[model samples]
Every structure is written in structure tokens, then in C-alpha cells.
Target: MSVVTVRIPDTMDHALRAAAADAPSLNAYIVQAVRRQMTLDAARKLAAVDAQAALDLDGEGDAL
Candidate 1:
């Protein structure tokens, strides 16, 4: 597996540390959290794009 380095602000670093304290491994916790957030963000963006496309189609049909 490839590895990447990330630099976090002091506040976020502290927060991540606190959140990962209960986790078995800090790396695993960060990976899981990032993956979950990415999934949610992608889903939200997709929904917005779909909604906009539907609106555009409606407008086009109205013009026809």
C-alpha cells in the first residue's frame, strides 16, 4: 500500500488525536473517517448535479 503525509492545524490535530484515542489505531481511524466523509461529499455533489440536470431538462421541454 502507498502512504501519504498530511499536515493538520494544531486544533484539528488535537481533535483527531482525541477522537482516535479510543480507536485501536490512529491510522485506521483517520482512514475510515476520511473515507466516510468522501463518500458523503460525493453523494451530495451527485444529488445536486442530478437535480440541476432535471431542472435544465424541464426548462428545455418548456421552450419546445
Candidate 2:
């Protein structure tokens, strides 16, 4: 629908081009890669917050 231009480092650009060569289109490959990374990053952040909350609750009784 909408088109956007992205600039990548020369090495990354070459790698992405090679990786997406078998993909139907460059856009599709980029979208898939971004979506996968976003999911993993969000999960990692949530896990860190959950771990911190558990640690805080270990010593505090009812405040948490």
C-alpha cells in the first residue's frame, strides 16, 4: 500500500539482498524479518520486566 525508503549499511544491504533472493519480493522479506524481530524483542522486554517484578516481590510482602 504505502512505500518507504530504508537505508542500510553496505554489508547489511548485501546480506539482505542475498537472503531475500529466494523470497517473492524484497518487501515481503523485509516485512517478515521485521515482524519476527519485533515479536522476539517484545517478548524479551516483557520477560525482563516479569523477572524484575518477581525479584521485587520476593522481599516485599503486601506492597507489591
Candidate 3:
């Protein structure tokens, strides 16, 4: 495992601590949050690709 340090404003720190209270640890909470964001981003990209494929197929109805 690797360790990284980050700096945030006092207000953000306060909010993080407050939210982490329900989590097992602050580090774990941050990791989970990052993982969730990554998953959401991937889903959004996939949806865009799917939408484009649908548009491309729409004009193929007459060709097929």
C-alpha cells in the first residue's frame, strides 16, 4: 500500500470528519467515495457510447 497526503480547507476538513464518523475510518471513507465516483464516471461514458450507437443504427433501418 502507498500513502498520500492531501491538503483541504478547514471547512472541507470539518465536513469530511463529520461524514467519516459513520465510516470505519477516514481513509476507508475517502477510498469508497473515490471508487464510487470512478464507477459513476465509467457508467456515464458507457451510456454515451451506447447512445451514439443507437443513433448510428437508427439510419440503418432502411438499409437492413
Best by TM-score: 3
| Over 4 Å off, model 1 | 51-64
Assess each prediction's global lDDT (C-alpha) against the native: 0.79, 0.80, 0.81
> If ranked by TM-score, best first, what sequence of candidates would result?
3, 2, 1
2 or 3, greater by TM-score: 3
Q: Which prediction has more favorable lDDT, 1 or 2?
A: 2
Model 3: per-residue Cα lDDT at residue 34: 82
Ten-residue segment with the worst summed lDDT in candidate 3?
55-64
Query: Of 1 and 3, which scores higher on TM-score?
Result: 3
Which stretches in model 2 have alpha-carbon errors above 4 Å?
A: 1-3, 51-64
Error (Å) of candidate 1 at residue 3 is 1.6
Rank ordering of all candidates by lDDT, starting from the highest: 3, 2, 1
| lDDT tens digits by residue: candidate 2, 1-64 | 6777888888798889899999999888999898899999987876778654654456556641
List model 1 lDDT by residue over 18-57, tens digit each: 8899888888898989899999998787677755465445
TM-score of 1: 0.60
Which lDDT tens digits does candidate 3 get at residues 1-64? 6787867688799889999999999988998998899999987876777654564556465642
Evaluate residue 33 in candidate 3 and report its C-alpha lDDT on the 0 to 100 scale. Answer: 92
